[model samples]
Target: MTNFKPGEVTTTHIHSDILNRNITLSVYLPEDYSDLYKSKVVFCFDGRDFLRFGQIHRVYERLRREKAVERVIIVGFHYESVEKRRIEFHPQGEKASQTVQAVAREIMPWIDQTFPTYKVGNARVLLGDSLAGSIALLTTLSYPRVMSQVGLLSPHYDHVVESLFQRCQFKDDLTIWHVIGKEEKDFKLPTSGERADFLTPNRTLNRLISATSATYFYEELDGGHNWKTWKKELPALLKYFLSNQ
Candidate 1:
């Protein structure tokens, strides 16, 4: 098959046995994608916002045009609704475990079948923001052999997630790019209207990751838990992870 365009996008839907629903994944091939390259694949949660609000395609295009770093294939998981997202992404939600199972059993296998994956345990990345980020954290910890890097953009951290981090074994190759806003110490969730202190919990998570042998980069950036900060920092996030710099 001839390469589509430098930044072409296509999509696929597959049924998730664990969630008992069909899920959509938007796939974006990088500027120079070819069989000769060992493709790094980034599986992002909260993908709608990552593409819309985060404008990752635009940023990724610029990175490629400028020849800033090595590029990766972007595969984004699109949630059906905000309510359903809560069910899947939240640590305490009804379908939380189901979401992880779906990714491990359904999504990851599908990715390997369809894409030119570099490696299962090294070049694969699992990432997201807020509650989505929390799911990334849980999934990575649960299946350390599946992914190497965890990209967390102001994730919603709680006691259960903290306990998991404290108890789980980290692969020596594990890397985390965690960015939490200092203002997230107290705030209301966008959809649920629930009050949460993300900063404090993320700080605790930072400490937990610090105790592990994993390569981790945790930072308290200037903005709160919103898309603005995430969008602005996304290029740096991509470069940091993709370039290993």
Candidate 2:
């Protein structure tokens, strides 16, 4: 943490016409960021948690110092609250579709136009965990061309998700990295107090994505659904994203 050359971190609030709200974003540009060439842009949801609970920033800095993966830009989408996260990221949320569109139509374009990037979907990554992961998957499905690269960590599943996969078409150029905990078979919902089988649906989703022509990787580990479990997987996930491209 001390020896690595730290990246520049900046925060901003951008007004989105689609969501009709000021969306908060934080960007991490590696020490090697250059204007002469493009860099892969990783757009992460659950911005605040990934930095705090997930320790992605620390992990990323270490990765860069080790030269494990090539330098890339990381962007985090900050949610105001848990309810706000669900309203936009949940599969059944009213604004789910709009949130997906906003990432593809609004945020990505801004990132590309403002920075030296590939200016296409393949050069971008959508990464999130749980509900945030669910929206990442839906966003990729909704706009395959603009969001071809994705990382979904234990995506919270529902019939709506399964139905979307059943109805949508999968393109060949997509790359995906999805993971779930083997012990996450059943857990009590924090909000609804209902029993849910996260493992089964994640398996179903694996089969669904595996059946497509996507360049995909799926894993089931001996862990549960929490930041402790996810933080350890950050290196692998980021490597997977950088490896495929």
lDDT of each: 0.83, 0.83
Count backbone clashes in candidate 1: 0
lDDT tens string, model 2, 198-238?
89989988888888888999999888888878888999998
Instruction: Write down the RMSD of all candidates, one decimal each.
Output: 2.2, 3.7
**Candidate 1 positional error at 3, Å:** 11
What is the C-alpha lDDT profile of model 1 across 47-151, one tens digit per residue?
877887988877877877777757588888998998899889999889998998898888888878767676567678888999999999888888888876899
